[model samples]
Target: MMIANLTGMRSFLILGFPGLSPKHYGPVSALLFFIYLAIAIENIFILTFVIFEKSLQKPTYLVFCHLALNDLTFGTLTLPRIISKYWFGDSIISFYGCFTQMFFVHYLGSVTSFMLLVMTLDRFIAICIPLRYPVLMTNNIISVLCGFAWFIPLPLVVAIVLHALTLPFCKSNIIAQCYCDHISITSQACGENVKIVQVTTLCMAMVCLLLPLAFIVFSYISILVVILKMSNAAGRKRTLSTCTPQIFITCLFYLPRCFVYVSNTVGFSFSLDVRIFLILWYSLLPAAVNPIIYCFKTQAIKEMLKKRLRKTKIGIKIQLSY
Candidate 1:
């Protein structure tokens, strides 16, 4: 059998959903638009709050800022293209464009998993080794860690993208999801190299997803032991409260991701729509919920929001009087 040639310009048609109709696209697009908007606004607010509030300059809050920025970038890189696909029926993406999208999607996702690990370490230090935390998690140290989280994934993802580019994608031009990703794009290639792609992708997933997850679990376990040893109830409550948001966000990210990887590795049969939904859930849901969790759960952020609200109200009242 002769495989198609990959010598010319190629484009992909992103089928937003497998069974969705033209009539359903409108409502679905609107819903996704609002979700994207909400994710952007919430993350931007958190990022701005942390940047402006001098009191929030601690290592822990700085990690929050980093995560918020990650969420903002992740949502921006993904949702607009997807929204356009459903809203205007513009599903065609150029060859390079699809690869670019795939690169960033995996890159930022790996960065986020590492960021969660960083947060877990922050909490572990604050709770388990409180005396040394001030010395250990200095601004400079946190800066270096955050830089590592941001840049470390670049080379790995670049290697993956380079390998993917070598594969001949002449078999199909239709992506069965709202956006491009490593697995989705590579699966369309026509060659025996598919197994290589799958194995390499699974390896990347283990490195990017499972490694950080293990660190997070270990950090929390140590922290839990420390919390249990603490005799003061109030102190225990405060510590748990501070750690809750990160824990929730971690679960939001890793649980679905683990499921997707395990299912793929085991050849579990999931419907096309269900797989798409799982991908969207793991990718978008954490971005939407992270800021909400931080704002509602973190006392400092609540106070900052309240203070800002009061200032806005006072400015409005003065304007009306004038």
Candidate 2:
């Protein structure tokens, strides 16, 4: 937020508000802490609802449960730092601290992206290949795929950690973004021999992000055509609405990623204002938005939450009456 302020309004707008500001960090920290607490409380409610409610037990909702967990992983990674810095203003991070944050951000981010691809593919199979979906997206398949998503990025993060940590930081160690982002580090390291940053960025994008995005696009395009031809507007709306939250999430992530990649590889002197703004929007706001998107966009989940909360309140009242 301070970075956005320093950069100017153009920078702040480009970054999209994560609902924080330079002057507001002290108070803003309290708000974020409450937000994080709410996320935790909401998640606890979700898990409890899923566990006790047999009707809600299914592969699709299970996938959603996993997504909520992933949100926590990504959310906690960035939010605490914001809260701490705002309350304490202790903005300095050690080598391990910054890398730890980056590793989780990248790892969980990749997992979430891949899981979203798996989700659309799951829907495609279920809708397009209905009989097989039950057999195909079985507990074992979900387990294996989710496990694979969890582990696939470990090796990639390990390599990045090594390369990034190995770089000597005789220059200024202060990271410019809200968190320790790769571009910020690379920019500081850049000189005549910026080849390493370019190569690493390319390799990371290709092997980590691009492949999954390609698959997602291909999968969705085919599914959309099939839905469009269904001749039932209601059916088509249902299918698309089911995927709306996921689509919104994907576009938010991929769009800035496109911007970041262009800025990094093309060696464009991307205005510092522009760059910082992009980083915040790309990294922070997504976590805050994910839960709200799910609750609002998906009626089933919304109802589930409401029913559980109502029941819990009644139970408490009953106990108190005793």
Candidate 3:
């Protein structure tokens, strides 16, 4: 039975994993449920801690704060409905609703790439131009840049979705992937306009992914050169240590994407199952792991978290004794 609202927009049935057996749906949904919870808890802890901690009110930490927020938003935006799909056999999403999800998915993804670029720039200045770092990249400047990162891609995303809406989705309402994305939705579109939409969206995605990535590589190379030239061993160690988390997280975010792009370019493609697995792996894994990286790598945050954990343990013990 097809359900539509007063607007007469048809609903799309999301196939979380097209190849998975019906019997496995329960386990898959349960796994995703836990991952969603982990993403939520870890990022929420980072956001909450950053907001309340006075000592962590620097531009660099604030950049991390923005990243944590982005991860949380991205997970929340993409996960719940799919979880519903597998857990309750509810795969239907309204046409406009699917488009809305698609827009935010791409938009948040663009913002994350830009934010990583911002972080690279932040590190570059702090390491290479230490003397002018204070005057050059102030908190307010970083704040404005982060604000721009989040909002600047809005129009492009909107335009892409708008163009997609113009396409006639007259046939299949079933999306093969877990969620509504540009590729999945546009594939359902009929007519010659489909190619145009695909090409345009691909071009936009390449720009969003590559441009910032180029700068990140350049900035990191410069940072590496600067680190190598440092005479003080401890200083170099400390500097590299600070960058470890970002480098790791950046790799987590970008490497899989680069692999997929390269595979596509070389006329090689993954099985649908592998492609879907890679998508979920790269998209959600980094968000869930980022907080752990920051917690352990940054001395201040690590110490603070340890103190909080100890306090919690003590409180639990006292409660149990009563």
How far off is residue 254 in model 1, in Å? 0.8
Regions of candidate 1 where Cα sits further than 4 Å from its true position = 1-9, 263-268, 315-322
Model 3 clashes, total count: 0
Estimate every model's Cα lDDT from 0 to 1: 0.87, 0.69, 0.89
Lowest summed lDDT window (length 10), candidate 1: 1-10
Position 230, candidate 1: lDDT = 83
Off by more than 4 A, model 3: 1-9, 309-322
List of clashing residue pairs for candidate 2:
none
Q: Which scores higher on TM-score, 2 or 3?
A: 3
* TM-score-based ranking: 1, 3, 2
Residue-wise lDDT of candidate 3 within 199-277, one digit each (tens)? 9998988788889999999999999999999999999999999899889889999999888888999999888988988
**Reference-based lDDT, residue 254, model 1:** 85
**Using lDDT as the measure, which candidate wins?**
3
lDDT of 1 by residue, 1-322 (tens): 2224665237887876888888888899999999999999999988888888898888988999999999999999889888998898788888899999999999999999899888888888888888999899998899899999998888989999998888877776878888999878887886788779768976986798778888999999998888888899998888899899888988998888778878887999799988898899889999999999989888888898899899999999999999
Count of steric clashes across candidates, in order = 0, 0, 0
lDDT of 2 by residue, 51-110 (tens): 687876676667667777887777777777766777876666665677777778777887
